[model samples]
Each structure stands twice: as C-alpha cells, then as structure tokens.
Target: VRATQNAKSKMAEVMPDVPKKLDDWKAAADTLDQGGQIVSLYHQLAIFTRPSEATTAEENAKVIWRGRGFELNNDTYMHRQALMACLPMTLSEKLHNDMRRMRRVSRKTVANAIHLAPVIGEWRGTATPTLILAGRRGQLMTLDLYDNDQGNFNGAIIGTPGSGKSVWMNEIAWSYRATNAQVRLLDLGRSFEKLCSKANGQFIEFGPHSPINVNPFTVVDDIDRDMAMLTPVIAKMASLSAPLEEVQYKAINAGILRVWRAHGKDMTITALRDLFKTGTLEDLEIHNDVRIKDLAIMLEPYTRNGQYARFFDGRANIDFSNDFMVIENEELKRAPDLHAVVNMILLYQITQDMYLSRERGDHRKKLLMIDELMQQLGEIGADDPVKARVVEEAARRARKYGGSLITATQAADDYYSSKQMETAFQFADWVFLLRQKKESLELLDRSGRIVMDDAKKRLLTSLRTEPGVYSEIYIYSPMGEGIARLILDPHTLLLFSNRHEDNQAIDQRRARGLSIDQAIDEVLRERSGKPS
Candidate 1:
C-alpha cells in the first residue's frame, strides 16, 4: 500500500510497462488493505554459450521469449547480477542492493505470485531413470520404468502406424537391457529384429518354412499346472465362433491329461489331438463325447498332418539363454484366424519359461514387450474367456515375479476395448501416447476412459514424427502426464530401423563377416559417405 501511494509512475518504463505495473500494484495494495496476502516475484535466467556462438544463442533466446509475447532485453551489463541471482545458496549483498534499486520486479496478490515460481512443469522421474527424454520446452524429463516406488513397471505405447512407436519402444527395451533386465518381445512385422540381433538375443520368426516353432504342450511343472496353463491355448484352438462350453473344456482337459500320461514330459498338440480322436477317457469317467469329436476337426489345423501344423505343433526350439528374445509372428499376424489363438499360446509359454528361469537363477527383473497388441487383445478376450484370463494373467504375473508387461497399440480404445483388456490396461502405470488421427481422437473421447482432458486431447492430435529426426509423444504415468521427444542418434536409429533397404544394407555388411555393431557402423558410414 505504501509503495502504491508514493511510487506511482506515469511513464511506461523498463520491460513490463509502468501504468500496467501501477495497476497491478493497486490490486496488490487493495488485497493488502483487505488483510489478504501480497507477494513480490522475481525471475532470472543465465544462458551459457561459447564465445563464437553467443550471438546465435541470444537470437534463440529472443525467439523463445518473443513466442510468449515478451521482448528480450540483452542487458549485457547485468550478466554478473543474473549469474549471482541464478546460483542457489550464493546470494550476494551487492546484487541484492542493485535489484532493490533497479525496480526490475513484479508485485501481485499471493494467488497470482504462486503461479510465477516454484512450480516447474517438468516431471523428474525416479532416481535411476530407465528412459531419458526432453519436455517440449527443452526441460529434461525422464521415465523410471523400473527401480521406482511405484511397485509396477508395466506400461503401454499407443500411436498410429508410421508414428515411430516401434523405434521409441525399441529404444526403451534396449535401455532396459542396460540395467541387466531380461527382455522378451512378442512382435508382429519383425519390428524388434535388428535390436534383438544387436543385443545378441534370440530372434525366432514363426512362419511357414521357418526353422523355429511354438509348442505350448511342454511340461514346465506338475501335470495339473501344465494342464491349467494349456487350457487357454487349447480353448483358443477349438472355439471359433463362441466361448468353449463347460463340457467341451472338461473333454479337452481329459484329453490333455491322457496325452501327458502317455508322453510324460514330451508332449505336443498333435498327441493330444490323436488322443481325442480315440474314445479313451475311461479312467477319469470323462468319455469322448460327440463335442470332443467336433473339437478334433477344429484342432486338426494344429495337428501334425494339418495345414497350420508346422507353425503350431513342434517342440520349442528357442532358448532363454540370452537376456533378450524377440518372437516375431508376421505371418501369423497376416492370418487373422490364427493370430489370436497363437498370441494367447505365446503369452503363456513365455511366462512358463519365466517361471523356469526363476527356478534356475536369481529373480532378476524381466520385461515382456508385446507389439501390435491392439487388435488381438479385445477379439481374443471376448471370444475366449479362458484365453482372456490367461492374457490378463500374463500381465499381472509379470509384476508378481519381478518383471513388467509392456504393450503397444494403435489407439486408446483398443486398450480399453473389453473388460479383460481394461483390466490389463489398469496394470499399466506408464503409457506413451503418440500422434493420432482426428477420428481416432474422437473415438478415444467416446471410449469412456478418462485418459485426457480437452487440452491434452488437442495436444495428442498435434503430435508429430520425422523420418530421421525426433518424434513427439505424450508420456503418462502415475507421476504425471507430459510431452516428450524421442530423438535417436544415427547409430541407434540404424539399430532400430526396420526399413527393408536399411535392413538389407545391414544384412549385406553382416554377411561379409561383420559384427552387428560393425555392420551398423558400415551402413551409417555408407549412408553419410563419411567415416563415423
């Protein structure tokens, strides 16, 4: 009130205008008179630059400030004062006196002053950050996918095709490997092949004419546990238009037990199907009914002499010996009917391996990354309740056994498409949302999940991706939601590149007796025509 009475100036002085400053002061004085709190605000910035690039740095600063409708002062004389003000716990008497005399300040009521400082928008991730990223304003924001008090590292990555989600998530899975975490990828389109190779990981491609195959019938534990685990995969194979009936499930269960009794630890779906063909469940009082015979025809495609036999019925050939394994099913993904059932089988088989790994060694942290997850989740869940439970349990059991379940989808609704899918999504404490079409955004709005508000929804629609540069994404977790840019360096880009030409280049160099790193470097050098 005293400053407002005596220090009223008529001219528009310095930076923030004089008459407007007095108006602000009058408001503060009124608040003071009414016994409300009045507060003062001050700000300082110190930009460090090379002597050669000082002018360029100053212009960049002007561009940033001008975007916010503020003019830059370029006060060369106050450099020392600026440095002094910015250094924490180093207040100088001379700088304080100079600030008092200069009137380079703003005063407002407490409510207004609170917004001026002490409220940094950036989220500082956990102490040991798994992924480092940059906020929109170039502030440093990071992600602590593991080693945080949040209790679970499960998360999702959602974006439209060509939105750079593959590269972004490949980088994340790569980063987790740095922490010695075991990583496995269930992928479509072979998005993880390059990185898997780079990490000396197992890359098993499931398709016709492929050397690898997935057999879910192997006995990992007791017969009952293996039976319970195979229940979902078997249900997915037999049921086409509807969920399996109780009688069919019991018949399938009886057939599986007989196969185990016959083959012991070495069993396959072909063996189970053969057992079902014969009327031989007399011991358990579970006779082969007509429904069981109908199931045999449905299960024929997965049998030895059936069409989809090679891909579905064999002993598992891959190993968890390495910390990383990418099980890519591009061919199966193309076959919509087969993709849903195989996905459920793979999810359980991987977790069973996880259980075996726990028994063999220390319970080190592991990561299960499922790419192209949107379509299969809801369809499989609604079609087969048993498979849906297994799918959701894969994510839930990940946290229980010191691991994380990370999935990527095309949109938000796909994550919440079914009750089981929503349950799986609820386990995701961290999520990445990239660019979306306007129509996709509208669907997300109507999906009835309170994911983002109007402003954030607008932000999501405006996200962008550059082919060789950075891609912008909205990162969400229990901590907070903020935008981040995933900018990969040239080498890392080559490691994550799935483009056929780039991959062919890498493969050509590798065929010439080059290591993964050496081949990638050769590719980078060839692209740039400069040795790097």
Candidate 2:
C-alpha cells in the first residue's frame, strides 16, 4: 500500500494538469488498454488527444509512466484483460485478424499432412495386395483406400463386356508387382496379357491341349493338382452305387481310405493307384467282396479302357515333359469326367499351395480372380458331394492363408442358388455390388437386407443423366466397417494417384511416339476433316 501510494504520488507530480474529466480519462484509458504495454498505452493516449488539446498535461502523463518503469506482462490473463479493456475497438480488430490468420495456417497444415501420409494398407501383411476396382463412370476405378487389417475385404465393380473389366484386372495385377503377392488367374478369356507384361509375371494358359487336363485315375504325381480333386468323389460315388448294406458301405469306405493311405503321407492319387496295382485285398484288410468290386470299378476308369477310359488315358498320355502344357485333344471333348477332375484338382492344388505358403510365413498374398465363376458353380450341382467339399475347403483356407478368391458374374442369383455359393458368400468377409440389373439388384438387396428403394431411385436418377457411365458400388469388410457406397465415374478409372500416373505413362507410350505438337496437330486435323 505504501509503494502504491508513492507511485500514484509521483505520477500526479509528473502530470499536474492530467485530464480530470471522466469522459476524456475513459477515452485515454481505452486506448491504453489496447496498446498492451505502458509505453504503447502512453503513445496511443497521446494520439487520441486532440491536436488543439495537446497540452503539456498529456505529454507529462506519458513521460511519467515511461520514467516510472511501468510494464504490462502480456502472458498474464489479468494483465491482457486490463490491456484489452483500455483499447476495446483496437483489441476487437486485432483478435479478428489473428483468428483469420490461424485458420488459414491450420488448413494448409492439414492438407500437407494428408499428402505426406501413405495410403492405408488394403490386405494386411501383404506387400503386393489385390486391389479393388470400383466402377466409376464407364471405367473401372479404384480408390486410394484400404480396409483395416482384419483378414477380410469387400469390393464391387460392375461394367458391360467392353466396359474395362479386363483392363481393371490388368491394372490391379500390375499394382502388386513390387509386393510379395502372387496372382493365379483363372481367366477363361485370355485378357491379362497387358497385366502380365507390366508386372513381368508368368501367365500359364489352362485351355484344351494343356497337359494338365483333368483325370481322376491318373497317378497324382503326373496329374494336374486340379484334376486330382475328383478321386475322393469318385470313390464316394462308387460306394453309393453299391448295395445298401452298411457292411458293404463301410468296406467301400475302408478300401477308399486304403487307397488314400497307400499314396503315403502326401496322399495323392498316384500312391492310391500304386497300392491297387501292387497291394492285394488282404493287404487292404477288405473282408467284403462287394467293397472290393466297388473299389475295382472306381479304379477302372483310371486303370482300364472303358466309358471313362478316355478321361484317365488323356491325362496319363499328357507329356509330363513340360512344367506347364496345354491339353487340347479330342479326348477332352468326350471326357466330361476329365474336365471335372482337372478343374477340381487345380482348385485343390492352388488352395493347398497357398496354405503351405502361409505355414512357411511367406508374406506373398495370393488372389484367385474368377470370371464367370457361375459357370464353375453350375458344373458342380448343389447335390454334387465333390463340388461342395472343394468349394468349402477352398473358401475356408483362402482367408486363413492370406489368399482371396474373387468371383465375378453378370448376375448374383445365377450363382447364389448353390449352397456352396452361399457358404462361400458367408465366409467372404467382403461383398461388392456394382451396377446390377434391376432384378438382380432387387434379389441381392432383398437377400442382404440393403435399402434397395433409395439405391434404385438414386441409380435411376443418375443413369438418366449419364447413360452407361453412372453406377454405384457397395463394399462390406469383415472388420464391421459395414457397407459403404460410391458412385462410379468413367473419367477416373484408376483411383490412386500413382496408379493414375502409371496409366497416363502407358497411354503416352501407346501413342506411337508422336511428339506433343504432332499429336495435337493430328487431333486438330482429324477434327478438321484432314487425314493424318
């Protein structure tokens, strides 16, 4: 209190004629508050004083504060508040400017941060992951997005025949070249050449004349892993055809197991065949004659020349000379058994290999992209035991082994009828629905309980304006992220910025090495009705 009184006494001595009017003192105080510091406060007060009234009094007051060594600490809230109170209008302007500047800086910082962050990983632990292409407009597009690493993915891409399905697949294939992912394409239509070229990956064609034609009777070692899948089914079928006696059925099953075990620990058809050719019924411990007969018949197509003879013979005669060979022979035409056997075997082998790869801690992700998957489903009727087992096993192992099986078709209903398809769908952690036909969409929507009405309405509205380019994509991932919708635009085919740049580079290369000027001239000339 003594210091405060002394300070006030000195201030009064320096400003003997200081403003006594309340209004003048309030105005000066307002200016001092905004200025913040004692020096700035005194300067602002002087500026507020009228020129006609710029007497020694105001000058003396400023000198007094300066000489007294008065200071305002900006860091203190109370001091700042006092400063602001002294300069209300100036404080308001300064606060407004400061907020605007801060907002601008924040926006720029956020944009830079997003740009620096790499895209999210789509397939967990996979360096080379299978990319999901969403149909945007008329082109197949992919977003620079990834689902959480929960061992599942959902993707939907829709387009007509020429709408770039193959192109999109090619792009995805190429994207994984640098990673440890392997792609096994079951392309009925050989459209992955460009993808193969860009990724520098090998393409094995599995059409007719391929040495890997399906055969259940052929020795497993020489057999295409795909064709070997039918052995168990054939054994089962043979048992079903026998008498209804339980003893006979059990015996048949035992004989089949003997054959399976005879293949040794590896469990292949070749071992089974060797066992039948060398081992006696006593060796197999088969007490029932009916079981032996059934087993012999089951082996006949593979070992003897009969109705199913060609199926086994074609596979046996295939030149094991090449690691990969095409089996294009008339025998394949008459041998439906061979076709079924081969496809099943291939599916089995691929799945097993994938599982083994996982066991070894190999980080290479595998993708089985099946176009016209419905056709394969159709071949294996719902009642077919072999189809059911293979599909179930494949679906189950696919997730466990860090592999994915993508099935694409024109309509979901055609494929959804099979119990196997349903099982596979349930196991599939992700589902993608592209621009489907109205009926097809309704069927899927109803089955999945998606809001079909709103989707249909929006789709119709978009289509009327954009024609074939407009479509919708719905994705569901296993991590409970649930469904997400996106509109497809043909203009942006590839979603990632890097992928887009790569496509642009490819386009430029395909332009026949024309200079920019020449290309522009060609376009202009073409538009002007001139021949280039």
Candidate 3:
C-alpha cells in the first residue's frame, strides 16, 4: 500500500496530467465492461528488462521467466515463445518502478488488441500490402511508402564512402521505378547510369560542352515563389552586406519580375541582366533608394560572355516528359558556385513540375533523389529565417505535390556541420545510417532519430561491408527503429553495381545503338550463358 502511494506520488510529480490519463484509462475500462467499443488512451508502457550480457541464451531465458514476481514452477515449464508472447501484456507489480527509472518518457498511443497484433511481429498491419524489401533480419522485411501512416516517404542516408550508400540509393530508386513511380536522380558521381539506362530513363549530362542550359527566370512556373528562391543566390552572389544588400535584393527582385513579365517566354538570364543594367524600375516601392547599376554589375558574370554565361543563358535544351530523368553533375564538381545555383534551379523546376502534374489531376508518385545533398544546399544557418523557410518549403513539397525528396551524403558532418545542414536533416522523417566514421556517430546521436546508448552504439559500430552483398545498416523512423542488412537480388545487383567493367560494357552496348532495356536484356543473357 505504501509503495502504491509512492508510485502515484512519483507519477503525479513527473507527469502533472497523470490523474487525467488514469481517469481516461478507467473510463475506457468502464466502456469495455459495458460492452462499448474499445478506446485508445494514448498512454503506452514498454518494459525492457534484459539479463546480463555475459549470460548464455538459456540462462537469460530462465532468468527472464522466473525473476521479478514471476512464479514458474518446475512441473509447469513456460515455453520461451509463450513467455515472449506475453511480454507485451503481462502486468507485473515491480515493472512500474522500472518504468519510472527511464527518462524522456512520453505517452504513446495505446492501440487495442486487434489493431496492434500485426504491428507486433512486423511493421505492417492486417492485409499484406505492396512490400518493398527495405532490409532483412533472418528474412526480408518490407515497407510500403504509399501506406503514408508508416512513414512520410522522405528519407536521408548517410555513411562513409565505401559503406554501400550508393548501392542502397540505387536499390530504393529502382524499387520505386519498378512499382511504376516516376523516379528522378540528381547524380553527383556519374553513378546510376546503368540503372537509369535499365529503366529506359533519360541520362542528361550538364557540363560546359553539354548542350543543356537552364534559364531560371523563364523556367520558373511561379514568379513569386521563384523570386523568393532566387533571393539566396542573388544575396550570395553580390556579397552584399547590411542595408545595401537589402536594398539590392529588392531592386533585383523587381527587375527580374519586370523582365520576366515583359519578355515572357523570351526571358533569359542574359536579358534579365541587361534589364538590370539600363532599365528603370519605378514600379518597385524601394526603386528610389537602391542602385540598379550595382545589381546589374553583380549579375554580369551570369550574363552573356561572362564566366557563367554558358549556363542559364540560352534556351533549356532538355525535356522533362520522360518518366525517369537522371541529371549527372560530374563536370560541375569543381565549380561549387555554379553547382549550387544549378541545384536550386533544378529543385525548383522539379517542384514546379510536380505541382503542375498534380494540378492536371495526375497523382502518380514522384521522387527527387539528390546525391551529395550537403554540397548542394550550402551552409544554411539554423536560425537564418530566409534559408530556414526554404528548407521548410522543400519539406512541404511532399504534401503539396505527390512527390518525395531523398538525399544521400558521405558524413553527418556534411549535413550537421552548420545551421543550414541542421535544418535540412531535421525535416527528414526517415534516416539510414550506414557504416560511418567514429566522429560522425556523435552528430548522428544528436540527430534524435535514434538513441545513442552504449548498446546501440556498439550495434552501429558492428556493421560490416562485404562485396557482392549489401552492408549492414541501422534504419530509424517515426514508426520504429532496428538494425537490418540491406537486401538485393542478383538482377538488381547487376543493374546497380558500381563495377567499372560492367559500366563500360553497358556503355559499349549503348554505343551499339541498343535501347537501354535491350542492352539490359543482352547483358543479362551474357551473364546467364544464354543466347542473345
């Protein structure tokens, strides 16, 4: 009786609303007694009482069954399965104390028996839905992104270079494409070529010599939103500071809007730059205070005959009608400034396209997968309101448009090294931590998606990478968290492998004028000892 009062006092002290929760549970019980429908109290209790790590499996099993108020006699042996099965529900008087000892405790939705049964052994519930092999324990575990409730369909994968990050990205992209979802990738390392080809995807190479040029002014579907998107780039370019920077930003925004309006379909970066050079912008409220000449001088480099004149100056040479599009940025690796701008433009374009597609009543799934996302988003401050809004708006694209944005990086430092990186990762609903550097683990721990206790840390460090097979990965999401080895079949392995010879062979096949699908079939025949 004393212990019960003490427990109640502790609960009251820790949770001021304890009485409310208990009353709600009591009301639920009363309803059940009166043959009313079962109710959810939104309160949950999970008990983790493990035996000593050094103990044998048999010893651990024995200890779990008979310890702490459990009475299992010699004649009535408790099967391990039965004991484990009852673990979720058996109410022990001593367990309350253990629950109080834990921290960061919050109320979890208390699901009734029928609704909770399938969630016990697997992540899915009731009917077997479309299952994509996300990872495997003893057998393949599947997850359906379309389910919406299990997760938000957003994902972030971070790991060291050789830790199979690309492999997993390839698998997930291909899996979605196989399910008939429109998939796209912003390829950083010239990877995903073979896989892109296999899916009959358009592989676009953006380089100085490449015919592709993206003019953000004309390309942007919505001028107001695009003006906001261009603000960061303009701010970064002018190297503006304080009052002058603010004045220039407004002038340049008004100038672009005016040029885009006047030129309409003919508007390009070159024309926009020319307008800033000589055009008057009396329409803008701040036109009298700002110097249009300074803004034009800042924008000259992106205009005709300037250093970046070749990019975003001419007409857009590429088409977005294809279901699968892979934009390879291998050539722009050394040009960080141009790379960042182009990335923003592409992201905006994709977002616009997705919104337009949805507006046209096409609700098919779309994805924007970015490799080396940290390099693309640049160093955004955690508190910088403008950049913060940009990241938040990017996250909202998932709901507004029926598409998901996924990013993969080599280190958590790349995404958490700055405030901007911090905000970017925070918006993600799913995280996959592959084999990472010891230093990176600290950042991951701070991510708050997965607990970084000694046991979990040990589990993360124990992950191994093997050839021709998937590496071990720790996946965490709002639904749950676990360690599983990423699984892939032989055909997918061939398509997504990073082997040099295989890629060269695929290139050779493409050179022979074979369609990507035909090339894939031929390569499969060569691998199988069958006639092509």
lDDT of each: 0.75, 0.46, 0.68
Error of 2 at 38 (Å): 45
Question: TM-score per candidate, in order?
Answer: 0.77, 0.52, 0.71
Per-residue CA lDDT of model 3 for 265-317, tens digit only, reads 56776776676666456776444333776667777777778888777677765
Model 3's alpha-carbon lDDT is 0.68
Candidate 1 lDDT tens digits, 1-532: 5445434543334434555556777776778898889655566656788999988898998898798676778666777767777788766666666776788665567877776564576655556677888877778766767754655778888888788888888988899898788899988887888888788888887656776666776535766765656776787788744777787788787777777778865787788777777645675565656667777877998888987877667676666688899887776656666787777777777777777778788687788998877555435445345755776688766776677888888877676666556666677888788887887677756764436688767688789988898889887776667788888899998788778898889889889999989998888887789956
Candidate 2 lDDT, 216-243, residue by residue in tens: 3443433334333444455433432222
Which pairs, if any, clash in model 1? none
Give candidate 1 misplaced runs (Cα > 4 Å).
1-36, 41-107, 118-121, 226-228, 278-288, 311-314, 375-384, 417-423, 442-451, 511-513
